[model samples]
Target: MKSLRLIFCALWTAAFVSGCGAYSFTGKSTLSSDVKTFTIRDITLSAPSSYATISQEMTEKLKEYYQRNTKLKLVPQNGDISIEGSIVDYRTDGVAASSGGDKAAMNRLTIVIEVVFTNKFNEEDNFEKDFSFYLDYPQNQTLQEAEKTLVPKILDQLVLNIFGDTVAKW
Candidate 1:
């Protein structure tokens, strides 16, 4: 009976594993097999309000994200896939009003990126789009104080969104 039970458990485990053959924990990428390399041209800052280093920071983060998440190699120019873009908008605005309605209770920092994706293997997948993200902070804090913590978070999400649109096709 013990031997029969062990065999049954083995069969169950195998069945479960086989059923997940198509499942990918990292999420599915629609990139074709022919796409083995990618390039990200230097990101430019068009927003006068944005800091000087923001463009460089964003470009490096994007490259690192793609390298870590995908098997594609990085090339300097004209790879199977290429991305080029500029930061079009970066500004702060009042989001929530105080009880007196004369002042803001919360402030939001927003960033907008204009992206152009080129797919050498699949021209139909090429696209140009704008991706935006924001972070909210209490009105008591200055923009300088909030920016240090919020900018990184916003950039990370922007990169993820760009990745989803270009490769994952989500």
Candidate 2:
């Protein structure tokens, strides 16, 4: 009876460990390619000199997201597909304001991007589309800090828009 109990406990522990590895492949919902490799070319930023960091930030985010969510490797060249793009527009509008002042109490920043995705093997898979995102600036914050914060928010939205179209079904 003692030997039987020990064997049963060992079997139970093994089964538990195996079950943990049997997850439901959730990452597949976000990426379509089974190709396991891709490249995102350097995005062009068509803004003032201050906006240069936004380009690098978006590129890094794209690479990081793919690395974290899929089994694919980011290849520098000769990839199965490539995503290239430019920042077409950037604007700031007041969303809320003090009644007596020209300055805004709160502001919203919108960034518009035009992206071209190309599949080297299949022209039919290539796509060119525009996406836009906005971030709100706090009234108490300096314009400089607002500028810094806005880029990440836009990049986050850009990633969501790209991933949804490419992999997630609508």
Candidate 3:
């Protein structure tokens, strides 16, 4: 009876696993099977107020995100999937009012990136869109001081959004 129960459990587990056909824990199923590689062109710094390193940082961060999350290999040029874009906007503005209502209590730094994603295997999935994110910091902190911590967080979210749009389709 124990042996029979073990066999039954094995059969049930197999059935459950098979039921998940095309569903992957990493969300790779959304990408066509032909998509085995990807490429990210240089992301230009088009925003006049944006610092120079931001463009390069964003490009590298995106590459790293895809490498970590997907099985696709990184290529130099055209691949199964391609991504290119530029920093369209970068600015800081007061988001919250101070107790006196005369000054800002918090400031928000926002970054907007224009992205063009192309899928060779699935032309319908190609898209050109803008993804943006922001971080709020105390008004007392200078942009430079807050940027050291805030920029990374903003970039992380932007990358995630881009990933969702281009690959995860979520």
Candidate 4:
């Protein structure tokens, strides 16, 4: 019985180590061994709205997310993985109206981000996708009040989706 337990433990450890070697625990990336660096070009603001900071904030946040979660070096160009795109939409609409139907009870703010990810080492994984997310707030609140709080929250999910599609293999 003791020997059987010992063998089981050994097998489990071996499988976990081997399985994890090809992927990052956080990003869940199955990055090629030859891949060493990554690049993120400036994201453009294509959305026709007053949320001018979306592009800048998204670019910086994506850079930081990859830098924090991956082992790859951040290069200006010619990297193993390259990413770029735009903020394609910034929309707000009433989600729910008051019982009287005279005023909105809740409003939603949505952001759309489109990205093209190229994996030079594995061209099969290259893709262009649009990631979108939203936040709901009281209709009485001004966009200025809701914008500051909602932008980052929605952007976080958008970044996560992009990261997952590009590198996480999820």
On TM-score, the leading prediction is 3
Candidate 3, 1-170: lDDT as tens digits: 99999999999999999998888676667987788999999999889897658998999999999999999999999889999999999999999999999999999999999999999988999989999999899988999999999888999999999998899977
Candidate 4 TM-score over all chains jointly: 0.87
Per-candidate clashes come to: 0, 0, 0, 0
lDDT of 4 by residue, 1-170 (tens): 99999999999999999987755566555778688899999999988884758888988999999999888899999889999999888999899989999999999999888899999989999989888899999988998899988999998998888988887877
TM-scores, all models, native as reference: 0.87, 0.72, 0.90, 0.87
Evaluation by TM-score, superior candidate among 2 and 4: 4
Higher-scoring candidate on lDDT, 2 or 3: 3
Clashing residue pairs, backbone N/CA/C < 3 A, model 1: none
Q: Mind giving the per-residue lDDT tens digits that candidate 1 earns over 1-170?
A: 99999999999999999998766555655788899999999999999887668899999999999999899999999889999999999999999999999999999999999999999999998999999999999999999899889999999999999999898766
Whole-model lDDT, model 2: 0.75
* Ranking of models by TM-score: 3, 1, 4, 2
Q: What value does the lDDT take at residue 24 in candidate 2? A: 38
- Candidate 1 vs candidate 3: the TM-score winner is 3
In model 3, what are the clashing residue pairs, if there are any?
none
Summing lDDT over every window of 10 consecutive residues in candidate 4, give the lowest-scoring window.
20-29
Error of 4 at 166 (Å): 0.6
In terms of lDDT, which candidate is stronger, 1 or 4? 1
Give the Cα error of residue 79 in candidate 2, in Å.
1.3
Question: lDDT values of the candidates?
Answer: 0.93, 0.75, 0.93, 0.89
